[model samples]
Target: MDMKKDYDLLRERAELLKVLGHPVRLCIVRGLLNEGEKNVGDMQECLEIPQSTVSQHLAILKSAGIIDNSRQKTENYYHISSPLAKELIEVLFK
Candidate 1:
């Protein structure tokens, strides 16, 4: 592969890493990975964090395109948005 193309891909990966750098965001991602789709309340309960804090981290993850949300009744469900995120989280445990 071309070095330029490799560098570009690495840069993009770095951007992703930066987005996932926050402890709260990492915990949110890990929760989503383990539980599949979950609402903000569910994450808050599982992580033992404040609801607003959970929402803040979820928003960050959503903005980074690392997770997607769907509305079910009065609750919003979230799940991993990209296979790359799943892979990276998996690698973190290995």
Candidate 2:
């Protein structure tokens, strides 16, 4: 493989890992993998954390391309987007 391509891949992996390094973010990603897709309210209830806190983490994960979200009316539902995240969650949770 080309050096530039390898560097870009490594950078992306590092960025994803960095974003998931937080406990809240890890939990959110794991939850998303297991639950399919969920809105902030569902995550807040499951995590027992404030909605704002969950939303903040969700934003980071989404920005990293590790997660994706869709809007239904006013509710935003988030789910895992990266296969690496899903694989990691499976390994960690199982």
Give TM-scores for every candidate, taking all chains together and pairing residue i with residue i. Answer: 0.89, 0.87
**Please, what are the lDDT tens digits per residue for candidate 1 over residues 9-77?**
999899899988988888888888987899988888888989998898888888888999999999899
Cand. 1 TM to true fold: 0.89
TM-score, predicted candidate 2 vs. hidden true structure: 0.87
Query: Which 10-residue span in candidate 2 carries the lowest summed lDDT?
Result: 27-36
Clashing pairs in 2: none
Candidate 2 lDDT tens digits, 9-89: 999888877888899999888878877899999999999999999889888988888999889999988988899888977
Which residue segments of model 1 deviate by more than 4 Å?
1-4
lDDT of 1: 0.89
lDDT of each: 0.89, 0.89
